[model samples]
Target: MSGCHDCADCPAAKFPPPPAKAAHVIAIVGPPNSGKSTLFNRLTGLHQKVANFPGVTVEHHVGRLRADTDREVLLVDLPGVYSLLPHSEDERVTHDVLTGLRPGMEPEAVLLILDCTNLGRHLLLAAPILNLKLPTLVILNMADDLRNRGGQVDVAKLSAELGAPVALISASSGEGVDKVYQFIQGTAAGRAKVKAPLIQLPVLQDIPKCRRWASEVGAGAAYRAPEPPRWTRRLDAVFLHPWAGPLIFLAVVILVFQSIFAWATPVMDGMKTLVEASGAWVAPHIPTPLLRSLVVDGVWSGVGSVLVFLPQILLLFFFIGILEDSGYLARAALIADRTMRKFGLQGKSFIPLLSAYACAVPAVMSARTIENKRDRIATIMIAPLMTCSARLPVYTLIIAAFLPNRPLLGPILGTQAAALLGLYVLGFLAAVLTARLLKSSILKSGGTPFVLEMPPYRWPTLRSISLRLVDRARVFLRKAGTVILVVALLLWVAAHLPLQNGKPPEIGQSFAGQIGHAMEPVIKPLGFDWKIGIGLLTSLAARETIVATLGTIYGMEGEAASHGLQQALHADLTPGGALALLIFFAFAMQCMSTLAIVRRETGGWRWPAAQFAYMGLLAYAGAFLANQLAGGAVTRLIAFLQ
Candidate 1:
């Protein structure tokens, strides 16, 4: 500054000083499964913006809340970290933001959330954060659980001992959250303050010293850790059993698979009917043939194909939420750890992979929590292989067209549901094989022991589950309205170009058809025709886009009917071809967003390029083999039966 001031006559003097940050940023930090996200959702409600932090792959969420005076305050929900030490990318980003090392994201205050039931242990994290001398509110979450388990802590004493205010709140239930808001309001008004500790804190760099100091502080406050919940222990005994656990998990998977097919069919049929009706009603009103085709065949048919899967997607996420809220997913992770290690992956990889079933983008981002570099890369590489919700539309369309919905095993399972479950297992097996190969080769690294905190099981609240579904629905509809809509419109335009006698030409004679024809020979071995080739090209934008592409193509070709996309596909595909298509999608890296995320997470195109190429080859080979073998088998079965 002195040098710059002295050079006032220089061009540098014309530059203005950097604008001082004015927003009061309050950071919410806690260890994993401590209900931090629940609290964030509670405080922010629907007013939040999500983006990546500068120069990092980590996601950032900033939400606005109104203070007592009606002034706005910004809350930054940081990644959950056990410590301020930079062990993983998540921890590093949190550490940077808290320490002001991350430009423009420094927090004015901290909401240090701790699991109240395990306060003594969670207190260890408070030392380094308190030393930062930020106006901090040490929030002991899960107050209801703590009291129910017969634990107690003198909040005033704890506040005095730690030299910061403490608030006992159940973030999930919203009890005592008002105090958190008050602390936020006070901090925003510059009224919040922290006193000198009653006992001197150890240096931030000294782990053992800090641990001892934290324990002493807790004792001074008369903190008592809660006894483990009885049902939790009992359930753990069964759910964590080596053999029974896997069996139980298998049963749960089967139930979910059955429910997806059994329960969602009615809703899907209703939605399909509604979409068709809308397209029919709108078509006549449009008057112009070209405009009518664009509106009905392009927009309506395209988006509608993907929209029909909304019920199934929501159903999948519903089970995931219940399992997670019930605290069973943590147990599932522990059970999967034994098998994961054999494939050169740790238990942490399983979480991202499990989440990959919902979507791979967030799952890849979730791998940031894994401390090991090689493990994180391996998780990201194989994440796309999992059968995500996007594949549901295509899978269902193909299955309904070819596979009969007859009972298997006395109606506990059905042919359609079994086929769906088989596809899921197929994806998981492919992921494991790929992970093993990666770990054996370039990404080879020694294993890191898995450690996880098991949260106490609780009944999932209706509010939380509904909020999750609503959020998912929002994302789904937004994609349909934007990306899918645009693709559908483009496809329609391409199909109508080079008009004959000022009317649209046959789809096979249009520009889109030419591209599909050119690619047909390349995919012919896999039993895909030019129409499927066109769908495949569009699907690169997203795994679900193929449904929209096919919907538009078939609608324009006058093949779609009252039965919709499934009926249209039945005429175009053989049983072997449909099975091959499912296999191809199960293995392929069909999502561009996933590739972009991989590139960002890996910090280069080299990894994503290699990933795309490897998966592409595997998908091709798998589909080709399935088409050849299954084709002959199916043909022979028909002849033999005759």
Candidate 2:
């Protein structure tokens, strides 16, 4: 349990409230895709923090709502589920909390968010929850969608059918949602009633009785249904077409990648210019040489190199937001479902896998949504291979270095966009293929069918998109501001140390260079030298640190440091080295944070250790192959052009 700190004489502690003054708990439970998350966000807004349920890795969102007169409502949004009879880990978690079976969890009331258009079916879930006798309110989201389709749920009759107040609302549009919140605040203390199941339990087939009773209740409530699923059928035809759907999904992904490079170029350039100007202005004013160097080259330059990529990161999130909020991502999942089944995964795994492109840690966390154990573990295992945004910096740099930007497939698509698209495709292929291997060999699990509702397309609100954008920017900057900052300072010291005999320290003789040199022999096979070795070593903390590490290393050099990193690489690295490094990063397990999260999720070092070993081998092999193959192709192409 969580409580508000600002409230005067708040009766509860932050968590695990004393039994005598047990904190009021309200559970927001619903079936999957029933607008559970949307309602939670609307109720709590950005004032929410997620923490795991007592002992489980499954996290619940806790938020506060203003209640009647100088108090706040503590809201716990539970995992989405079909019924209290749990089949999945998440469903089990919800059931335990509601039943007081799980330790440290006791709910005082429940808010049931149901899909309005399918009230009869959604209420089948409500019957059991209602029997718990917790003060409950039924929020029928998608009421607007239902109404537009010439359907309506009779609220007055529904309030009578179930012994709970019913609110007709569209969580997306904020229609009647306030009433639901007010109901929670007003009734949590005394309204919830624990009682027997509403309909008599059937002797042998209780499930069918539940269904029949739900239909009967629908009739009693005068539940109105919309027009037949004609448009949905038609839309599914094109979007879920056996062959065309996948192609459309592919095109959408390609467009996103192209936009990342094409749309963000000007912004990226502007950021680069700003950093250079700041460096120029700030560097000469400092009095001491070492202090000035640390401020300019170590701090600003290292941080700036990574920060310039924020535009591309933001643009990527922007497009992803559109896809998700538009409901097309669900269709994309449906389209991928066919191939996913062949690999022993259902469509449920697709969301987490898709989310991996943003970052693997959260994607892995999102795997809790998947019901099956093996399926969840499998998703977590291959999630890191999804070509996350951290790879964007490395990819952009390498593509700029090795690949010429000639227009291909006419003037619209360039070699740069195509190459970038190709890398993402490679990552997808790698993830699917690796999952197949793991499913058949290590994990050895049977396939589970994917069950999901295609949420109606809602135009994403500016507020929603803006909130997400702010959250993403904060995460990116926090990583840059903290981890990269510390690493940059350390790398600066490493590159500037060991001055001896009154002569200036050389990078090759400094501690950092010596460390890089030690690993140089090992990495030389993959077309890397000591400087790249240093970047690779530093990147164990974070993938983005490679850029900062390289910036710090190069910034320390006398004349070479004056050149931009791209130019320095152009003069120093061969096309083969650039391609090989790109391939390595595309496949490598570079982020220690990802591995740590995996270990935590899997509950042991065994899985993360195996993940590290296999991913490392693959990265090394991939880099070596890229070096050889790309080197051969470049030589032959040059000969032909000559």
The most accurate candidate by TM-score is 1
Give the range where candidate 2 is weakest over 10 consecutive residues by summed lDDT. 4-13
Work out the TM-score per prediction: 0.78, 0.75
lDDT (tens digit, per residue) of candidate 2 on 1-642? 243222211223344344464456678999877888788878778766555554455656776654552334677888877888876668889988898875445767788999888877787788778877677788888887788888867888877777678889988788998788677756645554544443543332267777888888788888878875567677778878878888888998677656765677788779978997999899889987778878887788667756775776677677767877777877877777776788777766876676677667656755765656788889999999999877887788767755767777898888788889989998888888999898888777645545666876667777777666765565456544555567667767787777666443776787878999998888888888898998888776568667766776677433254337777676667767777888788889887656756765665567889888888899999988877778778546434533
Summarize candidate 1's per-residue lDDT along 333-434 as a digit string, tens digits: 777777789989987677677667766765675576565678889999999998887799789878777776777778799778988999999999999899
What residue pairs clash in candidate 1, if any at all? Answer: none
At residue 431, candidate 1 shows an lDDT of 92
RMSD of each: 7.1, 6.1
lDDT (CA) for every model shown? 0.78, 0.74
Candidate 1 residue-wise lDDT at 476: 52
